[model samples]
Target: MSYERHFEYPLSASSRLTGSLALGDLETGQRCYREGRLSVDGGRSLPISLTHSPATERLMYGGEVECIEHLRTSLREMGVELPGSGGRWLPGPLLLGSERTRVTQAGVLDCMRSPAFEEALANRQEGEVVVLPVLREGMKYGLQEAVCDVLGAHCDEVVVDAHHVPDESVPYLGRRMELSVFKDADLTLAQREKVKVAILGDSVASGTVIIGLIEVIKQRFPNVERIELVAPLAAVYGLARIAAFGNEAVPLRAHVFESLLNALPPEYYFSPFFPEEEMHMAKRAYSNYRDWWGVDKAGKPIAETACAGYGWSEAFFNPRKQIAMIDEQLRERHGMGLAEVLGRY
Candidate 1:
């Protein structure tokens, strides 16, 4: 069966696939592709060349298959390895990209222009990696569908991005939109004492998340003394609590990371780009690193969220979107490398 879906924004081929699972319809896109006949909307979505925002190229990352690989590595580290007898069944047949029938005409074109998309289309990359910020109706245009046409050009191993909704968009449109869905797992990992650790910046160690991890630590290392903690702030506190505790000390390892997560979940993931209409309507734009441009002094136009409205003008959306991806990848890779390095201790 083929999956029939709709999007408020224009989508790239890769992103369409990501959104497909959520669409929860028949996989018509696949069936149509096999039958060699599909009917889809015909439209062209333009790529942004230069605009008010910083210019950066967007890349697609992650997939169910990749998730499985990552999960395997994680499980293996936890001491569970699949046997050969388990066969391919343990790892299901992954979809290289969303089936073409799922995409509209313009989505196909955007996918063609993407190097990652092209590589996947040409059978160069492993497990279906594609590039995006795909133009859809609400966010991108028809870039999702184009990916469908291009996938066949590449080897069958390709994976599609398949996202329907625009990623969360904030005024700064940075990493702030990514949610930390695995905070519990993160605490568990930290509990293993497998990695050396360092804490940076100002943060609290008494937040709910921190308290939870501290309990875990207490259970694991009951007699560890004088936990050496280093931080800019003597103690971190919420706005309400900051005044009460002028200076305080808490176990460093237990609360630091958890506090950081509570302070910022969106900063950990990619922010979806909003449509021009939505962008213009925003009150302000926010980024994980810093605030973006704001409204004019006199306020030629004001958006709802003052911080977001003035901060996220449409001009910078494309550029900021691209730059965010590059920066995020570097951060992810670096942090992962750092984690592995620390784990060696």
Candidate 2:
């Protein structure tokens, strides 16, 4: 792995794929990342750029990834090690790498443009690594640019337009927006020579769009060796969807390397959920949630809500519309005004 360093995920399901057990429908793989804590520390950094929110950093490298607390209190704690695995993940495929330093729009772009990152992409040595960033959002945080900067003329890019919104089944916590469909695809790698690897980089919340895009990719660009998700802050629930897809359908070899995947609160899908253990990080935002939401009766703030991120659909949705949507959600759930809520933050 080209990552300068990688945090360990002892409970990742990828660690259990060796025996052909057909690991069916892993329940979003939520509890696996953390050792025991169900919530995480995060909130109130403020948005630094149109592309990302400081709320995001709290989950990535900003906060301590402590959910991985349980385990091998005994010699049995040392999980299986694949025969020749080289990456942090014990599975044969290497973990997706990122410098994972302080999160910033500039830093994201700069890192991708760095010589080290370029070398990382080049070293995918197994075969051609097609960069398939989901449309609109994929273009953010320098994800799409990374492909261009790294590969330049050799950049084989596929921009996919697959978005996930509230589904009819339940607008609560984001129901499955069935990503098994696609609206559009640009520069798609259709029916080409066997491209063994594909990289998907995004903030994976609801895995709807990804599963849909992957379906399209496998259909159009069939017979690939592996699909790697380069998600910055992926939800365990979302990753679970991908796992389910791989387990049931085409049997794809996907590698996801997220340091944490606490329970995804249905409210914001990503946040308002707070881990009491995380008071040390994003203390301001944490306080904001506790003070404003008044938290649940248990005194727990909505998990993942502190700073689940704002203007997430900036690529496709305008700010005005985005705020309006937030306003509606705020009123429906909290019975609070948008200005009242936003102002508190």
| Top-lDDT structure, candidate number | 2
Per-residue alpha-carbon lDDT of model 2 for 1-345, expressed as tens digits?
A: 111111211223243211111111111211111111111112111000011233233323233222112111211122211222122211000101121222323334433443334434655542366766665555554554555555653545666656667555532223443443243244344423456566665666656666666666677656655565555444444454455432233333222222323433333254323244232123344454345444433444433343343444441234344445554555555565444532432
Q: What CA RMSD would candidate 1 show?
A: 25.9
Clashes of each: 81, 22
lDDT of each candidate versus the true structure: 0.22, 0.39
Candidate 2 Cα outliers beyond 4 Å, as residue runs = 1-122, 125-127, 148-153, 163-191, 247-307, 314-316, 342-345
Please give the TM-score that candidate 1 achieves against the real structure: 0.18
Q: Which ten residues in a row have the lowest lDDT in candidate 1?
A: 49-58
